[model samples]
Target chain A: MADAKVIPFDDDRSRGGGAQRPVRRRPASGGRRKADAAAVRDAALSPLPGPQTGEAGPGPDAGPAAPAEPVRGARSAASGASGDAGGAGDAQQDGAPVTAAGETPVTADGGWDRRIAGGLAFLRRRITGDYEVDEFGYDAELTDHVLMSMLRPMYQKYFRVEVKGIENIPSEGGALVVANHSGTVPLDGLMLQVAVHDNHPADRHLRLLAADLVFMLPVVNELARKAGHTLACAEDAERLLQRGEVVGVMPEGFKGIGKPFSERYKLQRFGRGGFVSTALRAGVPIVPCSIVGAEEIYPMIGNAKTLARLLGFPYFPVTPTFPWLGPLGAVPLPTKWTIQFGEPIPTDGYPPEAAEDPMLMFNLTDQVREQIQHTLYKLLVQRRSVFF
Target chain B: MGKVVLVTGVARQLGGRLVRRIQRDPEVDRVIGVDAEGPGHHLGGAEFVRADIRRPAIARVLAEHAVDTVVHLDVTGTPLGAGGRTAVKETNVIGTMQLLGACQKSPTVKRLVIKSSTSVYGSAPRDPAVFTETTPPKSLPSGGFAKDAVEVEGYVRGFARRRPDVAVCVLRFANILGPCADSPLADFFSLPVMPTVFGYDPRLQFVHEDDVIDVLRIALHEPRRGTLNSGTFNIAGDGVLTLSQCSRRLGRPTLPLLLPAVTWVGSALRTVGFTDFSPEQIRLLTHGRVVSTVQMRETLGFRPKYTTAETFADFARSRGPGLLPPETLAEAVDRVAAALSIGVLDGAPVEDGGPAVTQTTHSSGQPG
Candidate 1:
């Protein structure tokens, strides 16, 4: 019950505002994976002074009471996975009273002033070209302050994404998160990134592997690169994993996202498991994830094959309201969404040669595929309706 | 017992500077500067020999000097004083061939240093994030300096095989940027209003012109205890900058055009004799190139003083002021910050005040 109060709509933004505060510091504690769930619960319940209490009220209760229950579960599960981040909760608790006691004088005015100063500093830095991008062209500062904030509203209010079993992801180290792709467009990927970021105790970023088409397009190419998405190739994937990043790959590619409305939940055949070999070579774990509710967002009833070929697209989706409604039909429907991260399959136990072994790669790929398919079926069965 | 060095392309700015620096080295007894034309400027104390490397006559000069160390600084991206694309190709490709042939026959030539450009790694959508020395280019250059560099490298490789005894070192330098840089990229950045590809902002890397001379100097000399030896290495500074970032730092406004329009503008500028806006250069501006400098550090045993950003900054200082002054931009930023904070404090949140207060307390007490 105490944990339910922590589900604020803009916690991520609040964290951004307090960029100068010591609250952003990672705790110096040792491994405490067992305390993850408790830490998350305690962090949620920690008291905050002033305006935050007013803002937190409408976030979770925006939907029905039934949906609010799972959101609490989602937060707990997310926190549980990042055991080392137990220190984050304790640190916040220690800082809470200091802010609360000084609520009137220091907290209210100082917070807004600091936020405005930070905004100005950010603008100045961007204009003066004072920023660092990694070799893969990932701009972490821009993604955090600008891009993530832009997407948080949609992830929080529109689909109301609930995450489950987040504890399955390792708090640190390289990980390959394999998820079934859907939603006519790949909005699910963005939502999945948001779910992992907001729920996890450590708030680790997910570096997504995108297709070549993403890089070929004009505006999308620059945005995608800035948002830390690299080409979905073995070299890039291996390079990212070797650097200890959490990489998200959708092996199904266009096939899963462009499937017809008749086969919404039926999992498509994942392409030759290149992701598995990449993980094996890097000696990291692979976490299988299943996303529900993205399929119903657009509800593709038919594929316009002729138009697709003409436009040089994989498929031109003819959704229920699309084409007839023109630009207005582009908006996705409001559907209740749930994303579940399953247990990570460790590939470190295998020999270095295992990456080259076709049999082992194929078997591991099938095992991961089956686990995601099974979870999808279960989540579908538990659902009361498409739109809650 | 002292070394006799032959430095080609002394007529150009960089070559003249390099020849002057090499002449000062105490270990070298003599330095011979060779080119098609005599040096217009000073070359310190180095002997100037007016001879074309593209002809067989270069062999007589190489043998007469008994040049043991040969530094090829002639491979250029654009025509320097008075030459076109064809002239550039002849000097780069044919010149290198004739010089290598002379080196093969002249037994005194034991050390060779060739300056190659990173444009050989043609930019494309499918390229790796960072290119190492061994990474084959994803796409071969269609035409221009890039293709010429690729061919020149190929000939160098063949020459290396023939003379395995020769300590041949090939240095592939990234876009050279510095106070005295006369590179195509430098000229492009110096334009009053730079034209950019509409949707793409490419990540570019640069090495200081001083660093190139330093690396070449090390490569030309014989291997001592802990210095460069014979091998192919990528030379670049420590960091990368986006094309947009470069424009902003230079305080210049960009004219974003569609890809086709950009191509049209490139040729238009070329015809007007503004700069050599070749197709390869356009491809570079579209999908920028970056190379790994690990070998340059560990294997070659050299560390560049200026980073990519610092090199660009040095280059930017030489070019005069832009339309938008730095002080005006700074003042605007400060004013906006103050106004925004004050506005938020006085208004907005209070307008929805009553409803927000009740909603906050209601939600907080509901759990209890």
Candidate 2:
């Protein structure tokens, strides 16, 4: 009964809306599954005693041993089956289930033998009815353990990401995370997801609002859904906010991701500030996020126009290495990435009716865009080099 | 004061049981149970009168009984009770038309409760994340009970317009499942090998039969006097489960079928004699549908006793297990695997579980 909270009208928009995290904390089992899933994924990805036989590659064609997404959401319904979550602390003997080495499961689930065994165990549980996904197809067990681990190597060692002003991220409740988008491919969004999860004070998961194209690709679509990225629509965003999730949005979309290398870091129009009206309607704050060094990851020099149209991509990016170096060129350059979270722009003060005002929306959109641009400039100035 | 009550479809188990339940209440003087064919079960403390609601004779029955309250339960979604497609449509659409015609003329009929289905909210690729009470369905149901429900709700809305004095309550119930309640979803879940679309596992919601009866009783007992009460509501237990989760819990292995091959599977199911396994049902299995019950709780003032998981669990319990024991070697292995999973999962979080991780306790403590 306590958590049956309808969207309260009396949002204390004053910055001192302190420590509202208790009412806003996600249901423990769901949170724990994600935390645990990510934990498992981390263990699996970490280098072990054996050779690196199968690392998940980072290209349009990721290897067969790609970062795992569940057959189900790894979320929503099945993963929320916290009925068995309390038994989480019972064993340390999973690592050598086949060999009976009696070593802990940390090394066990990570090893190649244990990898196949762990995957089988996961599959067996799914078939036998232990794993469940929530409505959104989110299996925290899958996302944290499988999807996140797949993205972690690129996030941690490759990019060598530096995050700043994470405390500016409100600890709880809904806040619209507005960020600049760039690169021939939008790896920035994925890196930001990793950054938020790894850096935020609460280790809160960022539900990125993605475009339809992301959900159109078969494997890519499923992985995006499992990782908590939803369709970039107002209805979806409002639902996430109402449930107290920190929503991430990149307004530039294809325009940001498909820009010429010459125009990189130059802010594009914020799509008429639809994201602002979403925040206004939901009565949440807007946190401006500035991502630096994503521009050089894939420098788009020219567009292979016919090829792009043939393949249904916005543009076929002609980076210096791409189409020349072939498959290997699809791998991103290890640019030094720095993500800064600026102070939040409060939207709760306005009445819900204000979302209807175009002029007001335009101004608020400008306010958010200006804040992000300023931060991007500041961070860019502070950077020593492109690759660090 | 007690009101004279008339209940339709008393031939069905739900209507029959409802009539008996209402008869015990001191708020009624007489109970007129109308059905074309009487159920084999006894209807104590109530009068059973054979009447075809689709025919004009229903108006005579309504006037003769002076029925002050009407509980229309004959809008059957499946052919199991309604016979054929035409017959189900007639009972759902034409029968509702005739019943509404009768109620319109009868000055005594001041309160109306029509049982509707959430199937009216058809499944589609481009639907809203959640359907509130007022959200127009994405794809309207085409030749099934779902379509009939849409038309039935339309007529009820029309009736509300013509006779503002009458209290019209339209309940859009989710797939109803319980031990004794038989419906299409129940039949499908009851199958040994449930066939599902290969790549999709849509979200599912359900309302227990007990909750359905309880809400119906609440509707008849507590009449609303305000503006918001007359509107439609989506009824389902809290939380949701995927198609995979439901089949797994039911202990039925799902045979994944490709998209184009799904209709054949549906026809195969129908040939095997499942009533709700039409093309519309195929769409539901593929996309799945969910409706918000905020109106059900905040405005309608009734909370389901069972959450989604608990409701499905009840159905699974009632259905019992298949060839295996309740606890199998697989389950025993899972318990160990789950324990291993938790330990491995919790290990990484220990390093990441900074001061913020403990903040949940701190915040809960702050309030204290």
Candidate 3:
């Protein structure tokens, strides 16, 4: 229950990089303070470092507390602190032999050593194909270690996303997260993914239902699949829910993301309420999520239809900086984001035949749409400024 | 009387393997292997008949043998022997039509087993993550082996409808991989350096060749079990491996080219007698295909022992070493892992020297 130490991104990296240096004064003197911090932080976060965390707590003060102990203890603790338990567990198993040999007196060198070992092990697994991908081509390991890390900086330091009502999502079983999609490039969907992953207590992954266009592109298609984004079809949605996965769907589609900035927070038509029917058929609850501030990131002032046609894009945005500024214009504004998950509407109460009832689908879609729209307005009023 | 079974495409490795396997089954009285030419490999005790399924002569052979069950394995995705694409199409489509036509007239033939490919559900951007047997393909195959499969399945359906008494079983298999796999995918992996589409890393699924033979053998005797009540089922290994993962596992370096360039390279490789990387294969590589085998397990009551990764691993072992040996790669990985654990100390520069010595010793211990 201890709060995670929120270190400034730059400070965290600088200290981490310094640990890889060959020369140091004395192991205990140089490493004591940071090692103590890591031990305390990780002990509470992960279970793999339990023994090591206990051992490491007193080592820094004792100075000569088992020369072989500190390095293994710190290494496991440091990696374990990264929120990747699998990698941390592997590091613990690997470091076991080194500790037994009592060969090295490497102190807080834990930070970089753990990273390098975890990275090398990851590379080995990838080359040897010693990994599992779900039937949806979702690589959980890659998403957890690589993709999440890559997106974390932007989600944390840049957007500073504040998630509210995350408990509305069930800790286990299938749930449909219907969020209003915005941001010209659809970066909201990714940030939303990160928000759900990092903030949720149970750490559930959101299997996003992406439009067909995402799969039509080359590199995008590959990354999309690895990141667990399947085609936004009823079959895929129903299947994911059936398998007890949290499926994320943006009913607004391109209309919400591609519309001019003037129409920012207005919810678009919820695509024939197909998602509602899918949820009903799967007998899961629908969690309506409203995201504010993503619309301000690109701020599309105009649309170049001809250029969009030429490039085969849905709409080419002539943002304040884009087209004229070229590649540099693509950089999004650092807007503060607030994503709130509303109370889940249970569809399990409906009869199985309710999925076929178009009238019910319409009413449910409208209810979800209105809840999201109301929350958006409420969030916008609460905010002092767009970028704050 | 024991069942009389006629197996087509026996000249191919899979066909020959299936024929021999069925011949050993006690329920089958006689197994007759039919093809345009005699099988180069042994077919155990099964009788060999040199009759192309594309011709009406197949009907005469079926009548003379009083064949009650026909196992069609002639649906080929690649050209065989001296035949070209046209020949493959003829063998797969026209051949299936003639065979089914003959079976329709033969009242004695009450059971038919068709070996189909999951490619019938063509890979496309809009495709569902996993395909069930009844899922309609998002995009029908435009041409080549996939189209031939579609046509063949169509003909089989018509034949089944015309003869309700006939129990037809269609086993749609994923790509097959094994030690003795002669599949196009096997050839693709055997290349010293595999060429892949630049930006696409498709998730590939494979069924072990042994699993395929086992399923076929079961399908051959399925009517007696009564579980094979003329149903179509998907047969694939449990897991999936991305194309990139497969190449890495094989220790084969990849040459990632543009989509158009991959097609050009494929044809060039075909012309050079290296491998037939067909258009259908190119699309598969672009948008990988995966089919659910739940029905194969629950309905057909079969489970593949080897997963997709395991099947590919078995095939990679048979291929020997590629540009980089897997053992050396594994050793390097271990060395790096050990060094990472031990190397990050105040004595870092000196620690670097230790791995250099250990690497040399590791390499010396390994054979070329």
Candidate 4:
């Protein structure tokens, strides 16, 4: 058995300093390295496996020349050999024959792992910075408080936010905040997060499910992460909910955020019950929140999909003057925001396999959407201002 | 150049005349008449739509007519102590709710003229001062006490808050009268006997029906976007006239009576069908009240075309041979006096300077 190659995980030497020692990479035969690379490709392409610890390896100071036990559970290496052998042998049951160069066969099929690694690298680049409390501070705790404090004046002076049924939000565990999305910029979600943390009894931090474009921006990606927003993916949603955190999602999605000003407060197309399925899988209650006043903030005049694609953004919103004037017009008018939380839709009664039932998921999603929509209309009528 | 206007409750006297006046207005495009009882035979030229507003479905019917402005004049509740006045709650409160709901759905409805009442202010103190838009009504235990005051205001306010783009104007009226007036004044004059003061003086305000129509027209043409107190004037013909003076002006003779005894006897007579005055009416009569209309005059540019004296004169002239003779007026007065002696009306304790009592003029009515 040959030792697997070791790669240094953290290479930002400035942060690690002099205390960090160099990691040793074991030199395998050409056939073996090729085999190991092929195995890594196979594992990367496979569906996410169940929780398993990585095989124990040699100490950090171990020499590259040292012979060690083959890394158990490195299924990728065996899968690669099986591929090279045209599926002749059971890669898991018996070690595949090594090539003449004494190294594992190297295949160019490790594209998915490289892409995922690249994404992770990109995330790291976006996050590493001296994010001070000046010019949009990035401290998660402080940012949460500041976002709320910034909204307090408008919430109090203009709109009387009557938050009902906040007890629906789970205290310790992950919960999905499935709220009606209004307004052009999804400011309702931002205000909702603030409302939950500032006004809810437990003051739980809400992890928002933002769009992919949000995480693709330079400064915005980092800020979103600090604010606890990840890509609005079911995987991330399930992960957060399973961890007992409050995950806020605007099921109305891009349609709700990009609705024309004429249909400003109306609920748009909900994305095929994805949020409901996610909640069902996680077995979390869906808190329905209806937000009034956010619709009037930017007032989406139209959308430019061509420009959005050209700029690598989702639905380029043409507010009063948003994209034309850039950041100047992008500033949302300080509208009085009233967010009311309706009774939670309990998914605890439904089994996790219920997510597989499309019809059931659709009906449940529609029910939630309708409740939020009706509540929004009622609240809008009750609200007294466009801008506080 | 008449602008098209739709007036609901057009079959009612005040609403009927309003439809006619709006139809005659050169600025009005046309008058669209809507009523539950259908258009009065005299309401010619104007297109009429028959719909009972108590039902929610009427909202959709009204929305289809493409009415540019709506003057809602239907009253659901009868006057205090009138049989089935409580039933009026459904029509006045729920009807208005339905009407406003319809207005929200209609894109053509740019202006809403709500015909509210000074009753929303409830009974006021004896200040001879005018009640303005800013005066908040006092809270009362009775359902009607707050129903007219709060529910109506809530509906209108809610509409304005939800739909700022729509221009909504509320006209809080005083007692309206004219040739077709069927108020207590007509009943009092027609009575052979009239009841007089027991211990306190009572002052009543009335706006001529013609003047009410005039104000509605002003609202239609001007379309002010806030609440306005309109058509509230002393019905005494000159200034604040005493209850006895009002009876005398109507050619009725009044007999002074004991307050408690009058109330008790009035109640007894009311049960016997000899009189309409309840013990409550007796109590209210003994307590003088007034509401200001200075804001209506200043903001809406309203000047009453007909004074109270002229209003009564016009009514008397219209009755012609059917008018109540002086001798008949005396007999009616006697019957009213006897009715007062019996307790028919039950009066609530009057507060002198409460929020409901204080009346505001034009200056106080201005929005901040």
Among the numbered candidates, top DockQ falls to 3
Tens-digit lDDT track for model 3 on B92-176?
Answer: 9889999999999897998899998998999999999889998999799999888888888998888889999998999888998
Candidate 3 at A23: error in angstroms? 39
- The CAPRI category of model 4 is incorrect
Which candidate has the highest TM-score of all?
3
lDDT digits (tens) for residues A129-230 of candidate 4: 111221111234324322343444344333433344556676777778888776766667776765675445455778888876664343454445446666
* lDDT on C-alpha atoms for all candidate structures: 0.76, 0.70, 0.77, 0.55
**Candidate 3, clashing residue pairs?**
A22-B346
| Candidate 2, B1-368: lDDT as tens digits | 68788899888888888898889888888889988886778888699989888998899999998988899988876653446778778888888899999999998998888999988889765666577777777679886778888999999999999989988889999988888777888888888777787666667898998898888877766554532445688889988777866876776667777777878878876776664688888888777787888889888888899988888989998998854332463565456656656332321221111122223312221101
lDDT of 4 by residue, B103-165 (tens): 888787777777776655554221112334665544221444235545776788898888777
Better of 3 and 4 by DockQ: 3
TM-score of chain A of each: 0.76, 0.70, 0.75, 0.60
> Model 2: per-residue lDDT, tens digit, A1-388?
1111200101110011222212122233334434443443333322221223432122122222123211111211222323222122111111112212223234323433333334444544444545555556666655554566566667655776656666677889998999999987878999998777755647578889888777555446555666777778888888888888899999998899899999978899998789999998889999999999899999999999999999988899999999899999898888878777888989889987999999999999999899899888877776656876
Worst 10 residues of 4 chain A by lDDT: A1-10
User: Which candidate order results from sorting by TM-score in descending order?
Assistant: 3, 1, 2, 4
Lowest summed lDDT across 10 adjacent residues in model 1 chain B is found at B346-355
The 10-residue segment of model 4 chain B with minimum total lDDT is B348-357
Give me the runs in candidate 1 sitting further than 4 Å from their true place.
A1-110, B224-228, B335-368
TM-score of each: 0.83, 0.76, 0.84, 0.39
Order candidates by DockQ, high to low.
3, 1, 2, 4
